[model samples]
Target: MEKADPVLERLEGQIAWYDRRSQYSQRWFKWLKGAVLVAAAAIPFLAGIEAPRLLIGGLGALIVVLEGLQQLNQYQHNWITYRSTCEALKHEKYLYLANAGPYASAQDPRALLAERVESLVSQEHARWVSAREEAKKTLEKLGP
Candidate 1:
């Protein structure tokens, strides 16, 4: 049994976290968008067939609600952001492994790797905190 390298572990963990979040957000974003599109497209069809007014109205409301959810949650933005972070982490890992890029002239690649890994994760956390704060302020402005 060997001690695990903390830098490698942190790098792998962050990569996994971002990748999972990216996929989850992407899935939700696509599902919601697809639902909205289908509901929107069905509107005219329902109208043409003289569907019940209540049914048509319900679908219209669904579209509005779904779009609102998408906008509010920002699934697309999260998906893209998380994915980009994940790839950035991967790039750092590769560069560290190859002792290239910023690590090419480093005295301690492992320590540098840890520092860079933490930096990337910290930046992501800062962005998330900022976004949440902005959303809170917007909601406050909107009032209850």
Candidate 2:
């Protein structure tokens, strides 16, 4: 049995992790959005049924809280960013394997490929940091 290339294995693992994360975030974002919408739309119906003020107000507050969490987490943004990074990494890996594109000229294709993957991951991290800071600022504007 031929042993797998370590670099290829690692790159494949990273891709799988990112893909899983992206899918999870996408699913949860959808669920959160649907829940928020349903709860919000139910407020009027609840009020019409003479539901307690607390009940109606609670649903309204729930909507606001759900929306706030969604904004703060930025799951949708992460999903896209992570997926993009994953694809870029995969592209680099394949290019290196095929000795195609820019990798075709590299004397040390493995090193070059590793560098490219690290760069892409670093870019994704930078984006996450910037996004978190932006989200913090937006939350501050909401005044605690």
Candidate 3:
């Protein structure tokens, strides 16, 4: 009987969670973007048909709100970051399981794997913070 390593099991669970989260964020972003585009495109047709000004205004307002929601939620950014972290975790898991890469000849494989996982997650968080800061600077440059 093969002994089950708890570290590997925990790593697998983390990977699954991140993968699911990433997919949910991506799906939400896509549906929201599609809805916004459809609404925007309909504005011109509604104006041509001499639709009620209120209706046209409502559509424009809806588009702006949806876009604001997208920006505030940062769905695309979260999806990419989560997916990237998940992939990195999977790679570490595989290397440890196969006894390849840095995992090879490790005195404490479990500790090494855990450290690697932390490093990968920390790097992802740092990258996300940096990206947000850069975006804020760009927005500031563009003015309100």
lDDT comparing candidate 2 with the true structure:
0.87
Off by over 4 Å in 3: 1-4, 128-144
* Model 3, span 96-137: residue lDDT tens: 889999989899988999889888878988988987786677
Question: Which candidate number has the best TM-score?
Answer: 1
Count of steric clashes across candidates, in order: 0, 0, 0
Candidate RMSDs in order: 1.7, 1.8, 2.8
Sequence-dependent TM-score of model 3: 0.83
**Runs of candidate 1 exceeding 4 Å displacement:** 137-144
Q: Rank the candidates by lDDT, best first.
A: 1, 3, 2
**lDDT of residue 65 for candidate 3:** 81
Model 3 residue 120 distance off true place after TM-score fit, in angstroms: 1.2
- Where's the lowest-lDDT run of ten residues in candidate 3? 134-143
